[model samples]
Target: MTTDADDVRSFDQRGGAAQPKALSAIRTIARREIAEQLSSARFLIIALLVVGLTPLAVYVGARDYKSRLEDYNRLVAEQQKMIAGPAGREVKGFDVGWSEGNDLAVLRAIRPPEPVSALVRGLDGALPQYWDFSPTGIVTGPLASRPQRIADVVGHLDMAFLMRVALGLLAILLAFDAVAGEKELGTLRAVLSQPISRAALLTGKLAGGAVTLLLPLAAAFLIALISAQLFGVDLIAAGALAKVVMLALTAGAYLVCFYALGLFVSSLVSSQKTSLVVLLVVWVVAVLAVPPIATMVAQAASPVPTSQYLETRKDALDLDIRRQAELEMGGVYREITGDPEGNADTDKYYKNKESIDRRIVPIEVGYLNRRRQILNEIDRDAERRAANQNRFASLLMAISPAAAFAGAATDLAGTGDAQYAAWLESVRRYQDSLNAALFDDPPTVMIRNRGASFPAELRKPPTVADLPSFAPPRRDAAAVLSRSLPAIGLLGLFTGVFIIGGFFAFSRYDVR
Candidate 1:
């Protein structure tokens, strides 16, 4: 304690009392804080934990990414090969026509996992990695389901976890006693006799605390990033350096938020023990409690209809349309072919029925149109309810800087919920294009006697090389930064508000 006081006093004496500057005092305090943080055993422990755990996480995640990419390539290759196999290839007696080959929708809309996921696995669970498509339509596989259990609590060891949870706790450790600890040990009174102002003291602690917290995390992140490249991830080589830069800045903001909160609590409490307790309580509420509680409240307030409800309604409507279409098409086929009572022969009767089914497929489009409209209504309703629920969560964002920072980092990294929405829309558009290519024309059916419907001579299906390629949309840095501006603003506001509060509390704080 006396050494800390002497450290500050000696700096003031070196400059002489006649030239006691706030800048000098603040710098002195900041340097001293940095020295102490580096020398502490806790700093070594924190450093080892981050550096040790992060590369292992990256290595594991990178292996999974590599595995999934190989699967995607292999599946795509097999699909292309099968489509080029044979014309009139029989699948359950349905002739694979030239046009049918052109409409081969065998490829799954599977996006390879992003390499940056090693750093930030944001919203990856909520977004599907796979989707299946056939000529009729495409179906998105369900998002991964995680069992809610205590073992699943600290789920992944990505950079998000390191920053939001681990670094947050580390920040508190560095800051919980920034002011109160000094005061308790008889250093505060001696230090205040120097040129330092309360505002300068606060500023020094904030700056030094932030630097101290970020150094280890940044070093560990860079090391793990290189380790990932050794395992063939190559995130930086893949032009993700920009994303990594933004992620680091955003993560730094989160660490600073927690550090400032600790400083604010330390300033308000008179004792180090009391300050530590209050900071811990605030940390628990902000980190653990707010998110889940907000989610439950939002869900209750603005309920979205279940997926089963939508599917059931869609199926029932489709069945009704099919039944109506059959009745209408039966009448039309008779008028065109004049086969009424001409079905006297059993062979004629079967031919007439086949003819009706051929025409009915086209007529069914009208009913499918109606079904799409109803399903669209269901979709729009659900989207509206979800938007409302998001607004409610935003209210919680106002009070939780941790939430704000997490959101901003994820969005900027292109791994947030917004990114997930964008990916979904892209797939939907691709599906619409695929549907148009397959179903826009009238259905062509084969007669029972028309042996060898498509020539067995044409060995392969028509080339689908002209089809548009599905390029997954890329997230632009400028656009992402714009979207995340609000969250960044909140982080800034929280830091400023807490630091200002700390200044006020420390201005009149008893030093003796």
Candidate 2:
């Protein structure tokens, strides 16, 4: 029986056909598929599920973001005061270097939480918020945030949550029946009996379903962005909007990939029930099983120090620094005056005050050199180990697209490794400047030059006004895009491959 689809196909198959006809056929199928999906109970239930869950994620994220923002501002303010010398002016007892537990240096390495993290929070929330920067440094801070529950560890309600969990499953559910379901009911064969090409039909169905899925997401996304503003997130960072757009695009691509996978599976299978079951299993493995397995593999492959261990080791190193400083200081006194018990007893040392005084300056100089050498080695080793662990983790996640997206998304949002590097580099430079300023102006040496005694007060109380202010480096859109550009390209390539595979599979599908 000749039908309208058949007539359209006949017209196109003959000389009347053109690119427009092909596109029209594709669109015709797309429109019908879109209508069918929109009217289905499945679509309604999934859309409602998305709407119901998204707000909780937003609320929690917003609250966390606001608190962090406030913390960052206050931290910077307090550091500024210390640098200006108002806060640390009357610090108790004698001044010592940062390596010896002296809080003299106001240099702090900080990668503040990204404001947009409220919508798409990633690994940054779990990374160290701040670390003390010193010339001979022992930095101690949290590696990541501690989650209160299993849900916090498994997943949060941010955009990444939706991208990885909700939309991923939704795509599969929507498409698992796209071809096999129709074939089971004889609709696929009837549609194929028309003149329309199989490839065209598949293309239309996939495109139409993609649009239908995206429609609800687009609305939800708009609402989330609007909520971001109302939640008082800082949106003025360079390329903030650009980063959000990139992440949104990533989520869209991720969603479409799953949809295409579902279609591919449907085309391969004969029964819709079988297709759905197969796709669901695949979904569970891809989204759930792989990432954690990858993480465990990474942990075993490249063991990392626990935060407590790091903190404890740093404290031990600090104690060693103190002990070494005193030992060297005393060694210099004995070497100069032939007194092994030099300065151990202040009253006895005062018995030969001039002798002790004469050696004090040189003793301090020797002690500093010894302390700096030891601590530099410790710092270098710690950093190398941490870097190796981070690299290992990055490599293991290559197979897991969700992790890839989260890492890339976090980087784009200024809460990933890039920000950490930027923060570290900024503080390192500041520390260098501080060290230069400190060495150039030895307060005690200046006092001694003026014929003063040891431990003399500084003429200026060591104002940080002379030191250069540290501006935490922020990655612009271009830099962020460049860093994750390779990942983005790879993801797109994968999606394209899946799409092409779907087309080829459908072309060979048996309508019988």
TM-score of 2: 0.82
Model 2 alpha-carbon drift over 4 Å, by segment: 1-20, 86-105, 141-151, 234-238, 308-325, 334-340, 344-376, 429-465
Candidate 1 residue runs with Cα over 4 Å from true position: 1-15, 78-109, 130-138, 142-154, 330-362, 431-471
- Output candidate 1 Cα RMSD: 6.6
lDDT for model 2, please.
0.69
* Candidate 2 least-lDDT 10 residues: 445-454
Candidate 1 lDDT, tens digit per residue, 1-512?
56978977886788646554778777888888989988888788877788788888777667656765666576667656654654113211122222334334344566656667667767654466566543334456545323325525756667777778777888888898899999998788888877667888888888888888889878977887798789897777535677777878888878888888888888888899999999888888887778778878888887777888868876787678756765665466556557562222344435555554455445655554455555556666776787788878778656887788778878777777667767767776775664564333323332221122221111122234434445566676776677678888888999888878888888878877
The clash count of every prediction, one per candidate, is 0, 2
- Give the clashing residue pairs of candidate 2, or none: 126-144, 126-145
- How close is every model to the real structure, measured as TM-score? 0.81, 0.82
Top candidate when judged by lDDT against the true structure: 2
